[model samples]
Target chain A: MDSSPPYLSILGVFALLSVLAVGGGAAVLPETKALTVTHFHWLADDEFRDIYGLGQLSPGPNMLMVIAIGYWVAGYPGAALAFFGFFLPSSFICFGASRLWNRFEGSQWRLAIQRGMAPIVVGLMAAGTVSVARVAIEGWITAALALAVFGILLARKINPAYLVAVGGVVGYFFLV
Target chain B: MSEAAPAPTAPAAPAGPVPLREIFLTFLLIGATSFGGGVVAYLRNSLVRAKKWLDEDQFLEALEISQTLPGLNATNMSVIVGDRLRGPWGSVAAFLGMTLPGAAMMTALGVMYALHKDHAVVSSVLVGVGAAAVGLLASVTIQVGRKQLEHVLDLSIVAATVLMISVFHISMPIVLLVLGPIAVFIYRPHPKRIHLRRRHHGHDIKPAD
Candidate 1:
């Protein structure tokens, strides 16, 4: 682990993922999991699952797991470097793009591009959902919980924080 | 009597620049408290409700644009809001304010990981958190799907992507590369007319031929 240059790799992987991570960072979950768990073997499947859990529970973006991954690989330096490398490129890209986007704000072609993007983004997100479920739902109870959450979300307007809190309490007693 | 006649006017507060320190602190607070998967909702609550910095429609527009872009929606939203509030420097401030805490926390966890590689309590907490995360991810999927997926073609693409990735174990980059072009070609809309529906409307329009 010490010699693996895991921090460097984390930066590289996240930079790549950031570019392709359209529709939110969820779109990159499958790739990130595969690279971190399956390809690199830096983290076990369960560990990857746990890190992802932390990312979800923590404030801010769920993709903040990159920092956790970096930290796990190296140390504080790794975390700091990974955070800087991963976020800076994407932040600059977005900032510049936003400025340009405003210029074409009224273009029908721009509207068309956005329309075309909707399905692709949705498709990517759906893929991400499956990727997460496949890893997290190991048993019947967990699977049932996943489905229940899905149903609850689809049917009503429950705030997501409440759902996470309830799931945490239930899982602490039952699954843990 | 002279003092009463002079009834000194209260010193006019110096109208200086909004303190960057205050802005950074506010951003940090928003980042720390924005938990449980509702980044957008938490952002609204913090920025609009708590700080009163942005109005509802402004926040919504920023959210819409953020979702359309490639990055974390919350981060992207922060960039937009930061840019609006304090220009480019403010954007950097917001980005740092948002990410610093998570980075520090994760780094601490990493240190703990080095020492306690096989601790049961750590494992158990992670297990519990992992289970809860599944629920969170599922909820997000359904919520985003309802709002974004309207057309049957959109739903079909979603189903296909899920099946391809989950069942076939296809690489995501390849999936995106393959599907991206197809989506662009198939879903691209034909050029349409742009008309000013009302005079004096502030709709930013390109020069008409």
Candidate 2:
């Protein structure tokens, strides 16, 4: 059990995902789930959902929870590696591409790319929804909780932290 | 705050770059305080309304670049806006300040979860948290994708993408390879697409025009 191999795998998987995450973290959720659960078996489905929940609970980018997967596989070093693997590559891309993009100030192709990618991004997001649902919606109780939160968010401008808290309370009483 | 709000047409000064510390602190504040999600709104308030570091057009331009990139808009915006304020070092400082707090927090939480892998109560609460996340992601996708989803052709493209990935279980790269170009071509700069582009005119995605 020399642990470095899995750690490297974690870095490799997330670094690859960092670039391919075209519409941000949500767009890559299904692929992320696939690589982590289906391919690498690094996380169980439920575990993956729970870790994603941790990211959502935090204040910054929701994808930061990838740290949990790394930590689970290795240790503190793994957490550090996950952060590097996930953020660095994409940050570099944005840095370089933004510089290049400015040079194409009037390029019509830019608009076309934006228009073309938008719908496909939406579709990827829809699939992302399903990926979370598979792990989150275990039974009628969880499903109802999810639906309630969805309806509340759509209907009001309330902060979601409160909704997530409400969900925990509901689950504590009904689920456990 | 009023003093900080620059007019949209304010000229970019060739004066000394914004102090790197100021860029770091502003993003640090945003990273620490922005809650739940919708970091974009927090960013707008701080950068445009409060700090007056960037005008509305500049902020939106930075935002558009952020969204068009691959990572989370929060980090990407930090990079772009930070770079605008200073340069690569500014981007580095802002990135560190923005991500450090949340990264530290998640790391702690990850450690806690690992240590208590089978805790009955912990797992129970996590189940609910996960469910709530699903709801949040759903609303977020709908909100962001609303513009792209309204047109029939666009809607079909969206649906086809969902089916290809979710139903067919096709890997993402292949789907992007085959469909990404097709979708772009369908919306290319032909006369019909030009008309459609006009209909979608004034959208920030085509800001330079």
Candidate 3:
């Protein structure tokens, strides 16, 4: 039933995902995984995991990795499409909503909405954590690494990028 | 009027419009430096402590708007905070700065990955990186939600959300549609207990003294 050019399909998928990303990229992890891996066949599970890892190594938003996905599927054009399609719609929404929210600064429902959505956001984040873990926490070694990193982080405020790099060194010498 | 006029300290302080170049460069600095996913702390240090662009309340207000929107809180916060200081151009400037570095870096890395998919070292290292990232993502999620997870009602909603998404495999739009209003209704503003305004954003999580 696929009928469109690859670029258009890529654009359409992310553009829709951009709007549906209500609580942030993590909130939409399951859907994003489903779209890119299951629906579009853009990447395999292991490759997706690797790309997600690469995205984390970068400094800004985690989901900017979608650009990588776009690149894999359709080269430079696909990457451009993903960058524009994925970011534009939501950026516009954030831009417009921020102004409107400020304009109605004292709206009666503002607090209520913020408070109510808080738990939902938490739940979505947890779901996202689980989704990532399902793919990444494969064996005893990875599970131990993930657990160790988790405990260290919860206990203290160390920068994670360093830890991730150290893990690559560990993997290079031992896991391989 | 009581509600419209924020407390004596209006946070952003509006202190005349900031120069657009200042806005762009500062955000660009944040973009280049903020590593891992800890941009929030870096943002506070730069924008609030250093530049005095927003007071605590103003920063939290903008944070609420960022978290409530569909994009990443990082970029959304940049755009909103930028707009507060300047205007549309400010929003555009901040967003560009916030996203440009990572986008360029990822493009280069992805291109390299595409060229060499079968390199044993790359795959192995990436596997380790991916595993470590799971831990980091999990830690970030817990830290962000620690407050919301404390209460029983909020706990249940969080559980419901996780269950529906992870276990039941419900679509996001459906899940949001069904649970969003219910969550809000339970937390609906009650004027009778006017004590609600104090910790709206939970920016500082110290237990009440």
Which candidate number has the best DockQ? 2
Which segments of model 2 are wrong by more than 4 Å?
A: A1-4, B1-15, B198-209
Against the correct fold, how does model 2 do in TM-score?
Answer: 0.93
Q: Decide which is better by TM-score, 1 or 2.
A: 2
Give one digit per residue, the lDDT tens place, for model 3 in B1-209: 13465446555565568888888888888988877776777787888777778876677677778877888878888889888777789999999998999899989988999998678898888888888888887887888687555578888999999999899988888998999999888877788533555454464332211
Task: Itemize residue pairs with steric clashes in candidate 2.
Answer: none
Instruction: Name the docking class for model 3.
Output: medium
The reply for model 3, stretches above 4 Å from the true place, is: A1-5, B1-17, B192-194, B197-209
Model 1 C-alpha lDDT per residue in residues B147-202, reported as the tens digit of each score? 55556877777777777777788887787777766666665555332332112122
Ranking by DockQ: 2, 3, 1
Angstrom error of the Cα, residue B134, model 2: value is: 1.1
Candidate 1: lDDT of B130? 64
Output the lDDT of residue A30, model 3: 81
**Higher lDDT: candidate 2 or 3?**
2
Clashes of each: 0, 0, 1
lDDT, candidate 1, at B20 = 64
Q: Show model 1 residue runs off by greater than 4 Å.
A: A1-4, B1-17, B50-52, B191-209
Please identify which of the two predictions, 1 or 2, would achieve the higher DockQ against the true structure. Answer: 2
Give me the overall lDDT of model 1. Answer: 0.69
- Residue lDDT tens for model 2, A1-176: 45455777878988988988888888999999989898888889888988988887777888888888889878888788888999999999999998888887757788888888999998999899988998899999899888888888888887788898777777677775
Q: Pick out the ten consecutive residues of candidate 2 chain A with the lowest summed lDDT.
A: A1-10
